[model samples]
Every structure is written in C-alpha cells, then in structure tokens.
Target: MSSVELREGLVVVAKGIVCVVTKFTSLDNISVISQKEGKRFIVPFDEIEFFPAVTDEGVALIAPELDELARNASDDEITLAESRFDVIGRYSCGEISLAEALVTLEMSRSNFYRLKKNYSEEIGMLSLLRYNRGNSKGALKLTDVVERYIQESIDEVYSGSSASISKVWSDVEAKCISSGNPLPSMTAVRKRIKMRDEKELYKKKHGADAASQKHDARPGKKIFSRPLERVQMDHTLVDVILVDNVRRQPLGRPWLTVIIDQYTRVILGYYLSLHSPSAVSVSSAIYHAALPKFSFLQKLGVDVERYPYYGVPEIIHMDNAKEFRSKKFESACIRNKIKPEWRPIGKKHYGGHVERLIGTFMTGKVHFLPGTTFSNVVKRRGHNSDKASALTFKEFTKWFVKEVCIYHGRKHSELGCSPGSKWAEYFGAGGDAPMHPPIVSNPFKFKLDFMPEVTRSVSPQGIEFKKCFYWDAALRLHVGKAAVMIKYDPFSLGTIWAYLDGEYLPVHFSDVTKSDFSLEEYHAQKMQGRGEGHTPAGGLEDRSLAEYVHENKELVKRSQSETRRARKAEAARSEYLSSQREESNEIDVPVDKTDKADRPNYSRRATPFKGKNYD
Candidate 1:
C-alpha cells in the first residue's frame, strides 16, 4: 500500500471487509479496526485493496484501481479473490517494496511463488487475480444446518426471550452435536446479526416506536430569528409536592403549563394548577403570555424590576397533546391571527426546547425544595416527598416566580447571554426593535375569544347553564333567541359572555351570591344532593327529613368552600384588572342604575296574607 493509504483513520478493505487504519505496526503490516466486525487486525500492506478519499465538499471518491478491476473482472471473482491482485500490482510496479508487501496476506510462500510465476508467464495480472472455483481446501463453511440454527436463535431473541449470544451459541452447539453436523462459531453468528440494519432489528425486537426513536434519530436545533416570532408550549407534572391553599395538606403534584420563547430561551408565560392540562389551561397560558406581566406579578405579591416577556407568538409549536389539539385552542389561535403548529404524533423531540427547560427547572430548582421527588424512582426511593411537603400552593407559586426571574437573569449556555439581556437587546433597540404583538384593548374581550363556548337558548326565566341560571338585562332582548353562544371561564363561573349578533353581552348568575361558586364545585354539590328522599310538607317522616337535611348540609358546606375560593380568586383578579386598566389608559365604565330601576321587576316578592288565621 502507498503511504497515503496507510494514514490513520483512513478506511481500507481487508479480508473482504472494510476497516479503518489505526496505526502502522511495520512497513509490511498495519493495525486496523474492522468497521464491519469491530475487531483489531494486523494485516500486510498487500491485503489492502481500497481506501476512501473524500473531497472538500464531503463527497466520497471511489478507488480508481477498484473501478478499473471491476471493468475487467466479474463481481463474484472480485469477492472470491478479495482484490489482492490490485495490491500486488502496485508492489510489482515499484509503488512499494517486496518486504513491505509479504507480511500477512494469508498466502504461503509456495502459493505466492506460483501466483508470481503465473503473472510472469501466461495470463499476467488477470491470472494473479483468478481463484480456483473448485478449491474448498477443507475450510468450514456455514451449511444449511448452521444457518437454520442461527435463524432460530435470532427469532427466539426477537420473541422477547432473555437469551444472550453465549446462550444461543450453546443451544446451537448442542443441536449440531446431536444431529452430527458442524456448528458455526458464535463470532460468525454475531457478525451475521450485526450486518442487519439496526432499524430493522430494533423493529422486530422492540416495536416500531422504539426503532424510530433509537435508530432513526431526528435533527437537532430549531432556529428562530427574533423573540416571540415562534414559541413552544407544553405541560409537565411538577416534581415537587404541593399543599392545598387552605388546608395546607399535601396534594401530590401540580401540573404546570409553560410557554417558552424559542429564540431567546425565555419562559414567556406559565400556569400552575392542581387540575390536569385541558383547554382551560391552554387558554390561561396564552392569555398570560399576551398581556403585560406587571399585573400578574403584583397579584402574586412579587416585586421585580419587570417580568419583561409578554406577547402573542406568530406561531406556537406544540406536540399533538389532546389539550393542545382541542378545537377551542385552535379556534383561539385562529381568532388572534396566530398559527398553531402541532408536531407529529409520537415525535416528542420536536418540542425538545421546552422539554429540556422543564428538565433543567426540575433538576436545578425543584429538586432542592423540601418536598422534591428527585426526578425518578431510584433517586426518590428513600424520600417521602409527601411527608416532607411544607409549601402551600401560594408559597410554591411565589418561589416558582422567583426562580423564573432568576433563570431569566442567569446566563444560558445556548444563548451566550442571559434571557433577560437578550430580550432587552432586541426590544430596546429602536431600529431592530423586537416586534410585539398588538396589545389587547380589553382583557374581557380577549379572554372571551379564548374561553370555552357553549350554545344555549334564552328563556323567560333566564339562560340555564351548568344547572345554574345566568341573567343580564340585554339577555331579555334576546329571550326567545335559539342557539345563543355563551363563553365562560371554568376557573371563575361568576360571569359569562353571551354572543348575540356578533357582540358578546356580559351576563352574571341570576342569584348574585351563587355566582361565587365555580362550575366544578356547583356540580359536586348537585351530585351530592341527587336522589335524596324529600320530606312531606304536612307530615314529615323523621328518616326522610334527616336524609334531606344531611344532603342540604353538604350543599351548604360546598357552597362555603366555593365562596372562600372565589373570594381569593376575585381579589387577585381585581388587582390584575385594576393594573391592566391603568396600563391600557382606559377608564372603568360605571353601569347606569337608572335602567335597572326602570326595567320591569321579574323577581318574585311575597305579599302579606290579610285574612288567613289559625283555628
């Protein structure tokens, strides 16, 4: 072989297999790591017939000698002779010395002399390359028996058997001995299996999903030009234990919905709830993302310079999660002129940025908390996360917000700058200022667009929804209208927006006090009261009255619990609304009570009975 062909890391053919040259042992011998079999072999220079040459553009150039030989010889002849003549021809023409050519070419001195004499006499180089087709030479070849044994072993392994290569080889040996047939070595069997492509092997063994994820990996890194141009949204079950707001008892884990800016690696918005991810979670996350964070921070009682990230992204990239793929979420994105891009099903790596962020947050921040699960089962084996829990929902929220702020200010490896600095660099510069999506003119209107909608008809009593009555003076105008669309927040069922003639009229619960209860709590109470026997008015049965009273008491308890929750939520909302109104330069519109007084009183009032007397 030429010196160029002996370079380390160059690929060359040895023994009918491709190997990479690791180092030269001598002028005649080189150490090579076989790419095909993954073993080290020290072979003579004459055994190397081809080596790869790559161009500047990364195109592989085929060996000229191999191409020339192919034109003059059959492919089977090349395979049988293993291209040894091409190496011999180079040495015979003074390309290299004879001592450097005779090390380990797998030929005896007599055979070499015979080949050299044949080359000198009758057939020339072609004669030197020819192999006697009938010469078996007592070498062991894989017979039909051995091949069948190998196929059986592979099938057993693919069938979920715990059989290792050694075990399979033992079985093959036992079968061959019993049948009085020769058995192939384990190395040969392993090589045959390795020659099969990984994708096909994994698919047969583990199934298609595993095969795709393991063997058919995807490209890394999604590029974006500016902040908020595109974002990734996903939900994760938080790894730290959280307690109920009022009871201060462990509530297992909370679910967090996060919106991440792809360009700057900034966490744009997040929502934490005890409930699982749903359309409500998606809406809340987007609503938070599209508004200033000042109000939210104020409501959380967190004092920061600013929580700068707030905008509607041009495109939101998410996995094909049920919540993300919901019609309500898609409709909201459309209504706001944003595009929703759902990654292909089972391709979780497409949303890798947010997934990595969740990992980083859980590892760096959450694991240090008192009630951390420590990510996986092994790490959490001895730790009772529930018992160690000390943080209430509010406390956790505060800590989470602070950690997010710290993350924004900390340097990111990918960005080479803090997320906050990147945001400032783009948004602060006037000429190339980051393009912010249009500000929401009215929070109520913006939220309504995203809130879940239901169709109902207005009646003389009111619009009945979720087993409750909602009323508005404007609803009277459309009392008989069928298919009136009502949009409401599941978090706070205190108010709803009724869509009529392209306008959404605000509606409140008919009994003002009942509006304080969320739909979930109301439903719970209704279920608890269902099927209870009613007591007779004239003659009350003690058992029936006791059951009725017990049901009513449960209802009252639920009502009180719901009222407390509503009060807290309302306070936060009030603070947020006040801040929003101030920021938007809008004044609160006062309702005209004169119209309320002039409207006919539909509410029932009791009149005193003048003539009724007890005997």
Candidate 2:
C-alpha cells in the first residue's frame, strides 16, 4: 500500500511487475517530505489516488467505485496502467468524453471501448494522459498480432483485389520478419479480427484519405451578375414518416427543394412537400426565394434585398431527372428568363453542393434523430392510405414557404452563415468583403414563354384539371358557346376548374364523374406501348436544349418558314396602317379610333410580391 507521488529529479523505473523511485509531496516540497519520511519509495501514479472526505460534500463528483478502485489496485501495477486510469476517471467524471480523449490520443476506438467497459486502474488524468505517450504498451500479444494482421489483410482486400489476400499476408509476414516483430498465421489473423471493425477502420481511413486528396480547397469563386444565373437545385428526401395525427396514418415522403445560388451558396428559395420535385415544386421553391421573409435579418441590420442576388436565378443547375427537364419545367425556367443548367449525365460531383445537402438532411439529421418522426409525409401517405392523414397541397406548401425555408435561412451549420446572410456578404451589403461588380445586362433573355391556358370539358357532373375538377350551373351556360376557362394544371389533366369570363365557377374537378375516357385518352389507350409516351425521369441523353435545337435547325427552320411569312405580312399591314394614320394626323384630320376601341382592357390583378425581395 504505497501512497506516493513522483519527486523532482527522480524517474519511476518500471521492471517486470515492479517499480523503484522516490515519492514526495511536491516538486518544490520534495526535499522536506523525503527528509521527514527518511526513506525512498516507488509507486505509480495509479497507486497515488484520492477522494475528498465523504462528509466534506465537495463539488467534485463522488464516484462511489473510484475510492474502492484506488484502495484495491496494487502499487507496482499502477505504473503500467497509469494511462488507463487517467482516461477512465476523466471520462467517467464527464470532464471530457472518452471520445474526445481518444481522438486527442489518436487511438483506435475498440481499445478505448474495451478499456471503458473492463479496465479499473486509477491513474491521475487529463493533465497526465495528455502529456504521457502510451509508447511502452510492450511487444504485441498473440491477439494483438492476430488483430493487426487481420486488419492489414482486410485493408488489402478493400484497397485492391480480394484474391490478393495470400500475397498480402505474405507481404505483412515479410515486413514483420524484416522489422523483428512476431507475426500471426493468416488463419489466426482472419479468425481473430471481426469483419465489422475492419470495414469501419477501412472506411474511416480510406474516406479521410480520399477526402483529403479530393478537397484541393482552393478559395471558392466569387459570384457575380444575373441573380439566378447559377442556382444549385437538389432533391433531398426527408424521412420523418409524417402522419396525420387525427387518423394516426402515414402522410408521405417529404421532398426538400432547395434553390441555392451556386456562386454565393445562398439559399434563394426552398420548399418541402409530400410531392415529387415537379415543375410546380420548383416554381414554389423559387417563388419563396424570390420573396423571402427577411424582417428578422432586417432588424439585425442586414439589408438583404439590396444585395446582389435578392431575387431571380439566371441559371439553375439540376440533375438530369425528368422533373428537371419536362416541358413544364423547361417552360417555367424559360418563362422566368432562367436557363436550366443540367449536370453531365450521371456526373454528380459537379453538382455536389445540392447533392450533398440531400444526404446531410435525410440520413445525417432527419432520420438520425433519436426517435420516431413523421418526416416523410408523402411516403407516409402511401403507407397510411388515409386522406385525413395527408397534408393538403396548400397547407404543406405554406409550411415549407414559411417555416422550413425560414429555418434554413437562419441555420448556420452548413453555410458559413445562414444562407440568407451569404447573399448580403457576397453582394457587399452586410459583409466587409469587396463586391464583384455586376454585369451590365444578361445576354440571355427568355428563350420561352408561358401562355396561361387550361384543360376543360363540359360534363353532366364536372370537369377536371390536374386530378382536380370543377362544376357549376353557370358553367352549363358556357358549355356550348361561352369560353369556359378550365383553370387547369397544364402538367396534369386530372385536376381542373371551370372559369367563365374572369370569374371562377363553383365546382371541384375531383367531384366530376369518373366513368368515361376523353378523346385524348382514347387515342392514348389505343396507342399504348407504341411510344415511350409523355416522359420519364431520364432526360434526352447528354445534350442541352440549345444543342438539341441546333442539331435540328435546318428541319425546324424549313417547318417554321410558313408561320414566319404570315407574321411578316401582319407586321407589314400594321406598319402601313400606322403610316396612314400619322399622315392624316399631320393633315389635321381625326384618325379612326378603331385600334383603341377594339382592344378594351379586361379585368386585371396585381402581382403579389412584385419585383424582388432583395437584401
């Protein structure tokens, strides 16, 4: 029972299960303590342990087992196990977790896990464990040799070919012999080491090594000019298995749509929904981004709107999913003066920002949460099958627009700051960074346009558009002669609504009779399997729209030549009429007022969030 501490100028020498050294009170008080005792002694740091008085009620955590562990451990064994005790106590006391210590020590987790579960040596700690290197762990034991060999073999198998196992084992053996260390047989090695540990080690080492090589880490490029010129769009699946509380049933898998400014890494717009990343979803995402709620940031002195990219993306980079390239999607981007930048087929690294975001959200955070979650409303709906357990299309949309996105805008985990802050920093508003001057004007204009149109049908029951329908007695009046506008989803004919003049007629498309097929449907039914049909997820392989159009220019030009001639004739007629009217006005005569009278203004509506919400 040696109660001792190391004295100045005296090193503890550890022999086979024994030690010899002078123990004293302190570095400066060493002479006094030794003079009083009048004897030299040896004990490891582990043998020198203490607990505050039981009656003292000190703030230091009272580990009931600690005092017993100290009292039980012999003097000689403490020297060798000093490192072990220190790590355990510091870990048990929560001064620092075992993980932090292990990472600091750069040791394998398996060793520490075993030590944590089984070892009970009392070594004085963080102060010592940090300074003392565990170099004298001694020559490899039989199990240690076997484990090392197995890990090396597994590493070999993963690094290259599995059939090279024999060569790998021979290589390790030759190295061990060269280094004068005992080596294990291939069979002993393979049987002793667990495959899971090998796989984990291999993954950790290889992953870190690969990432180090991959992250060349050049400074990121500064974004300049047209707002959405480069939007990094990605599809992330959130998996909380959201369920309708009332029905206790599944909702659906929620898809997260993020429109990030590639140059700035600003999240221009974002949305979450039980729907796929459709055109509507993309539009909704951009719309919210185009009009973000920045009042909080404004109060924080961030003027986001004045920032370079307050709204509108010029180029949206997306994967080659069908949803990204469908006519509806292309039309939206074209109408909004945005070019859809498609990643090369199957090449993801180029679009890593948004792609990685998906992994970060689903597997990393959402699903990794400790308990159950109703995160994937869409997938849940498929599982639950209860309508009530589902989110109304409108409600899901608002939540995404208002909450999910707002949260992303403020959360700083991913982007250096909240995504919205990046906008200000990049644009030279809030940040002290120098701004890249803006381009005078975007060379690209809207290559396409959207004509607000609808799908309609006059029926005894009702008409539908995009899976919804409408029916009203007023619609009956317009059934034959009136222009009954079917407020429809040009994307899906299943839903529709009847509109007459500028008024919505009462009727939901879902309420329409579902008995018969329309003429388009009849044709589609007859022509089943004749073609690939409307579309699929895959895009038209490896080519951009401009390239596609360029390749077909001759044929398309010839086809549109007739339409071009008609348009030219109308322009010439209008020019002639204008010239005559101008001449008559010069002669002081009143000109015909037909032009003004013929095109009377109809009902008009104000655009919501007009212009852009920049800051």
**Can you give the lDDT of residue 336 in candidate 1?**
85
**Per-residue lDDT of candidate 1, residues 553-583 (tens digit):** 9999999999999999999999999999898
lDDT of 2 by residue, 263-341 (tens): 5566666656555566655655555555433542343344554332446666778888876777866876676666878
Candidate 1 regions with alpha-carbon error over 4 angstroms: 1-143, 152-156, 159-195, 199-222, 431-437, 441-443, 455-484, 490-494, 500-502, 509-615
The local distance difference test score of each candidate is 0.74, 0.51
